[model samples]
Target: MSKIKVGVIGCGSIAKHRHLPEYANNNNVEIIAVCDIVKERVSEIAKEYQAIAYTDYEELLANPEVDAVSVCTPNYLHAPISIAALQAGKHVLCEKPMATSIKDAEQMIEAAKESNKKLMIAHNQRFVPSHQKARQLIEKGEVGKIYSFRTAFGHGGPEGWSADGVNSWFFKKEQAYIGALGDLGVHKTDLLRFILGEEFTDVGAFVETSSKENADVDDTAVCVLKTESGIIGTLAASWSYVSKEDNSTIIYGENAILRLEDDPVNSLVVQYKNGEVVKYELGGIQTNDAGGQTNTQVIDQFVSALIENTEPVVNGEEGYKSLKVVLAALQSSETRQITSL
Candidate 1:
């Protein structure tokens, strides 16, 4: 099997902790080039990965040896870089919140279509073992029909995560577009859609920058979402989880309630109205070393999709749809009115 020669744009924390490591670990992928505006970081990452270093992403994109690229740049740069990579005959594995706006997301999908390239969004939450099992159970009717759900993804601010630390682009409105909403909310947006097999039709949101200092973007947000099938739910994303991360969800159905990542020990639990309870000890979610968890399988899946000539589970259109929900929530917050998707 020919290895997929991969180039990574953005030598930031996410690229380092997730993309870079995961790609290197994948046997079918070879790190061909590393790009970042920060020359020092790019050079170091290139040396570590045994790949060439390029400060200009365009230069890296021009390399014919690169078969695919990971767009791990800021939210603002995702659309342009991914579209360009696709046009360059390279499959794209873009970090989530596909783009800052619905228009940009649509353009990205169109670009992939025109290029006949695979565009996979790195919404890693759906690959969580417990979340995967929960989806399977729900589809098998273990939860009957889902009536509602509440999902949240929260952690200490990006200061603790981004490579630039407290001064990261994540705190800048122009660069991040939307803070926790894009950084974390989009994961839940994608995860809920994947787990319930439903699309959100309406959103009412309350977005705020309540906790973080010296940050112009939102630190906390709560959105009420209704699916096409009348399943209503609350989606919350926050950067104010100083105590501990709260990445969990609860789904209420006609016969049972599924608690995903709600408990420390058991990753998933189902409570039945008939006095039966099932606990699942699925493995942990992907996180930084502080969380003592493994990285996500996103890079391997991207490589497989490209190699097999198959659409990734989270393809360009799927990403665009998930991003639409996030964009709708932001619009709802701005207009103080319910937004229809």
Candidate 2:
């Protein structure tokens, strides 16, 4: 099969760190074009991969040789760029949280349907080995019916990753829309849905900008979710965590309690009612890049879905569902009451 010609729409940290290298490694993909509002970054990445570069995404999308594009821009740009790419006859792999709102996400999905191009969201956590195992256990009834759960994804701040530190677009409400709830919180929201095979029906939340100085967005958020099946859970996401830990989901079932830790090594543990504990050692699920390119697996799956003519695990609608949960949390936080999904 001929390699799929791919273009990268944003030359930010995520594209530089995850998608670029992963596309280079995938034998079925060719990095043909790259675009960024900053010409220098696009040029640098394009040169590194021996591809063409553009300062505007429209120019890149107009290139007939580009078969697909990765939308790695900020939250606000996701919908517009993705819809444009779909209309341009290119498959789109959009970064997570899908979009800033359900309306925009729905528009992107409609565009993908109208264009008949594959639209996948970059929710890489669903591809983790531990997460995959946990999902299988849940599906097979190894844990029986789930009762309650908790999940969290926290970090110091985006200053370490953003180009402009505290002045980054991430801290700006206009660009990022929401803060930790959209950034780290969406991942857990998607993961919980994926693991439990249930959708959140209602949410109650508390959001605040506690640690980061002069930021307009929330730095920490805590939320309570009620699933459609009546399972209750809490989600906590923060950019103010002095020490980083992406600990997640403790699902209490009748037979066992399943715990998932998002660390690179020790990721899962299951405790039985009979005082027996089973541990799963996930030895570095990262792929081939700095910090092992943790998101590569999902990108690879997107490419494969196109090549093999199959549906992506995290398709546009699935992404929208996850975004709804986060959106509900945001509303609940603002209103100080439960919001129904």
Candidate 3:
């Protein structure tokens, strides 16, 4: 494929801020079409990119020119659209929290396998400058024999970001299925698995809707997770942090303690038991208030993988594994007992 032709489904915040702009800017990609249920919004985006507009996603998928698609629809539509795209002989790059349930995730993966197309998940945290640096240090045994860790992701709420504002599908249970646990916590779940290079085996949590009004989904979640190697950690996700966004992680090891996103000035910091401190002044993490643009390498990698005919880092298996931890946490919250995977 000389140039990968791309189609974007769902003209929401994620598409407007990340997918469309990134695809238009990628020299190796051509924006062939844009789709959304909203006619006005989709037409505007299509005109901006000088491409075709589609109100139904099926029409976009049927086009022979589109070689790939970005699944940026509501949480519930992620799996179905991804599966359909794959079956249509197009590669897929899906958003986080791949699906509402494990069965749907499995079906999506199978569809990709049957069609022999790439299926990548948008787990952008793995591409953050600070996050990449931290992973290298951990892999090099800089944090020897990890004991415990804590990671959290919190923000004001989706009302200020979503295209629909307070009436966005994010606030609806039927559309979103789960709340903070899926939106915010799933990112941390995927990030932790990437940085630690381990799978969570047990999950115990408290997921609740503590803030906001007139919505049924949860607003906050606190989870206790145990990895396969017996590494214990706590993960908290929330939409009630009235303050600024919080995306931070701390890891304690026998030789040192590593911190990430905990400091705005020094994004990645390491302190050894010998009383030595080192800091890396990487740029700020991408946030919603800053237009939610993605410069974290996800788009570039997705394009590269498609052009080179290779599997991306956050493929279906990796995405499914990360999503399992989040789903387990939700189950734990309901059963009031630890869930094991």
Name the Cα RMSD for model 3: 0.9
Where does candidate 2 stray beyond 4 Å? 262-265, 284-295
**Per-residue lDDT tens digits of candidate 2, residues 126-187?**
88778888899989998998899988888787877765667788888899998988888998
Model 3's alpha-carbon lDDT is 0.92
Summed backbone clashes in each candidate are 0, 0, 0
Taking all chains together, each candidate's TM-score versus the true structure is 0.98, 0.96, 0.98
Q: In model 3, how large is the Cα lDDT of residue 85?
A: 97
Q: Considering only N, C-alpha and C atoms within 3 Å, which residue pairs clash in candidate 2?
A: none
lDDT of 3 by residue, 276-314 (tens): 999999887999877776575788899999888888989
Sorting all predicted structures by TM-score, with the top scorer first, yields 3, 1, 2
C-alpha local distance difference test of each model: 0.91, 0.87, 0.92
Question: Model 3, stretches more than 4 Å misplaced?
Answer: none
lDDT at position 255, candidate 1: 92
- Stretches of candidate 1 exceeding 4 Å from the true structure: 289-293
TM-score of 3: 0.98
The alpha-carbon root-mean-square deviation between model 2 and the true structure, to one decimal in Å, is 1.9
